[model samples]
Target: MFDKVLVANRGEIAVRVIRACKDLGIGTVAVYSEADKHGGHVRFADEAYNVGPARAADSYLDHEAIIETAKQAGADAIHPGYGFLAENAEFAGKVESTDGVVWVGPSSDAMEQLGEKTKARAVMSDADVPIVPGTDPIEEPDAVRTFAEEHGYPIAIKAEGGGGGRGMKIVREESEIEEQLESAKREGEAYFDNDSVYLERYIENPRHIEVQVIADEHGNVRHLGERDCSLQRRHQKVIEEGPSSALSEGLREEILEAARRGVDAAGYYNAGTVEFLVEEDPDRAPGERLDDDTDFYFLEVNTRIQVEHTVTEEITGIDIVKWQLRVAAGDEIGFAQSDVAFDGHAMEFRINAENAAEDFAPATGGTLETYDPPGGIGVRMDDALRQGDDLVTDYDSMVAKLIVHGSDREECLARSRRALAEYDIEGIPTIIPFHRLMLTDGPFVDGTHHTKYLDEDLDTERIEEAQAKWGTDGEAAASGGDGTTTQELTIEVDGKRFDVKLENPGLPTNGAGQQAAGGGGAGGGTTSASGGSGGDQAATLEGQQVTAEMQGTILEVNVEEGDEVASGDVICVLEAMKMENDVVAPSGGTVTHVAVSSGDSVDMGDTLLALE
Candidate 1:
């Protein structure tokens, strides 16, 4: 057991680690960006410190600031709760170098070895783990062209240091080889600071599966079974489940064991995931049984806690984070591989602040008004936002996760539907409707859905209907749901702390975003309120408004006032979170008012142009 642990992340995963540390009677320290000073995770932790500004690069990713905070808090260990610096091998090495400071993950050397895609592929191949046909350290477009010539079109060019499909590009033709390869390498360098890439034979219609393996310094390794992360969009996992409905009993055991072997080969310890792409043969029928011949290719290794670890925890009855702390403290895995038992089916739905009806674009400048999550016998909601918390546009869009368990996959689907319907959020768009739509989807219910299901086969109209039916409308605005106003009053008591009971204080303070004091240090994120777009707005005829569909910063403006344009023509481009979205003209007409410029920031429903 550690004396104190500092969590170097934000949102739900940070809160999860804090809770686990509390259960172990370990003191906890939380680091937050100025944007997350008043965040739920900060409030829940025993002590909190401000790292930097709202931007993650200056805050959560600022290793020196985090290290300073950890030393100041006297934390013996730092638990990075997925994302941010969770898998940064350099940060881990720094923590390891510091006296009495432990990094709750695999050794930094192991992380560096496994973090690179090409190296991990070679290790897995030597360990007898199946790997996709690929090349290592591809430096030229000719290599991509050569690989594509042999593997046929649709080859995957992936960054050596990237994951989550960030620095990956697909080449479907020989003419695209040169451009796509360079683009992949550029993205790799821009995001991961590595300009290296590899080429792989793209497996069409594959189910994204990952095996969770926990290891100890004493050389004990255990596999907590596999998670079917097949349901995805843009290569990002959406719905994840344990004990995939598609895998046969034999295939399941094989994949799980292979995962352990690969980790063991890497000298990996603590929690890690080995992702695989399980090929769904087109010739096979939807319900066709899989045999030992079923093929699953190695994807990549996540060297830290995963976003979907909750589903594995639900089925395996193990606290993976707690074990990470214990393992880092020089404790051996008490249970052997045989003692690890899995039961039932568990599924986790990522409740992200994105509009599924509009291609799952990230939503910004929104608040969690109602903020009600589902609760029941088999349901677990992991989140870190209070009702009045504004959406932090600085990092990932995932705000919460809903995990459900049942005796089997069938019951799990049913329970998930019930739980999703009970979940409520307001002030911004969400992908809950998409998750709810999947409950009735044939491929998903039957467990025949592939990784490209959402991108290739989903029904957009049906998703809109679900969103209109189940989603809270404009009436469910902020804490002032009645359409009034809110006031903030800060007071000090006993020179110790602060607490907010924002029931009533005075009149609203216009649109200025301010910081108030609270128990965790400072209050909620820096937010600037825009005037509301009330009343019935015109949607047709000569006067049509091209309003911002979400909160974002304008990247470019394509039209000026009095310019004639056609419907769907790009009016402006808005960048929200990390995604770029196009705002287009509603109908063909003359632009009457150009309300924004390229550098102007806008919120949801803020008019960018008016066509007459």
Candidate 2:
């Protein structure tokens, strides 16, 4: 066992690793950015260190800083929790060479070979795993067109070094091939730093199934069963389950064996996932069981712990993370392949802080006034934040994960409904209503919802109906934060110093709340303010107030003052949580004023421009 492990990540995943370390009686070190000086993970760890700024590039992803921090903290190993630098082969290599610090994951060589898409496909092919027909590293647009002509339209352009659906683009028609190809290349470079892309025959409807595998340096390789992660939004998984309801017993066995064989063939060690795209039979109905002849092909390999790994753990009773650390420490595989056990049906719902009705857009600014999660025999809440902690808008929107287990999928669904109803949160919108509705929705209950179910079939009106019953937006806005902590900072104004109490929203004034001055703290970017009652028009003055749709940094402003733009013309682009969103003109007119610049941070509903 490691004497100390530095967690090179943040939020729920960081908390997850820290808890694992504690269970092993291992010391843990947590790293945080300026924005997360007092983050939940930091609070839970044995010790914490400041990395850099709030931006991930400068903080969690700073490879050098993380390695240095591990040495300083006297950590014998470093655990790169999922996301951030977890899958970066270069980081893994650096840790491997860092004198005494061991990397608690797969070898960098294995990661580089298996983490890249094209390379993984080749290795899987050599291992006799069924692979999707695709071209090699595609460089020109002609390659995409040629592949599409051979494979038919609706080809998928995927980044060679991408996973979790980040650097992928789909071309549905011949006319869109060129444009989508360029867009795919751009995203591939921007997200993965690799513009090399490949084309494959895109399956119309598929269920995403993955097998969890762990191997030891002693040559023992085994699989921990499989997980069904079919429910998704814009390629991001929202819900996941174990022992796919769609897979036949025989097919399941084949898939599991294939995953184990594929990883073993690549000489991969430590924790990894072998993902497969199970193509739905074209003639099969929604609720029909898959036939013995149903086709399943290898998708890719995720060389790190997954967000939905809880589902696998609940069913298999396996401590995957513990196994990861043990394997890295030269520990032998605890159990043989046949000794692996899986019991009961389990499901994991990603409790994200986003509005489902509003296209799953993240909350701009809000404090967690209430964060009461559910509890019981078969429920587990994995999270980092506690009540009154402000939501971190600079990263992923997932606030936590709620996993439920039961005797079967039926009981699991029932338990999910009860747990979701009991899961209380305030001050920020979440997709809880969406998860609640999935329990009752016939397609989901029957385990028939495909990856495109949410985006393609689930009606927005139905989602709105569910939100009305379970959503907290209406009530949360009324409820405020609980006064708990306090901070004081000094700011210079006209060479005069004044002690001002910057109140957190929904908390009581610290004697002089209204007179609180902001912008003196680390995360002091924006604040909501209102004009005096008598100074501005009494109730409201109506012009045209163009506002931001979500909280983000202004990446580029397309329109300047007095510039004309038609309705739907993109006026600016926003970079939020590593995603680029276009803020466009709502109505055709001249820009009266540009309230923000390229480098300004903004909150949702803050005016970006005004038009008359």
lDDT of 2 at 19: 94
Per-prediction TM-score = 0.81, 0.85
Minimum summed lDDT over a 10-residue window in model 2 is located at 530-539
Clashes of 1: 0
Candidate 2 per-residue lDDT over residues 538-596, each given as its tens digit: 12423466676666677668888888889899888776655678887778888777778
Whole-model Cα lDDT of every candidate shown, in order: 0.81, 0.83
TM match of model 2 to true structure: 0.85
Best by TM-score: 2
Error of 2 at 333 (Å): 0.6
lDDT of 1 by residue, 1-612 (tens): 799999998889999999999999999999998878788899999999999887667789998998989999999999998988988999999999988889999999999999999999999999999999999888888887778778788899999998988779888898898878876876676567798999898888898889998899889998988999998888888889988878889888888889999999989999999999887865656666566779988999999999999999999999998888889888998898888888999999999887766567676557776688899899998999978888886677888999999999889989999998888786777788788888999888887888888878877788867765554422211224223333335678988667343442323322332223331322243211122341134233135566666665676688877789987787776766544567776678898767788656665667677777
Compute the lDDT of residue 177 as modeled in candidate 2: 80
Clashing pairs for model 2 are none
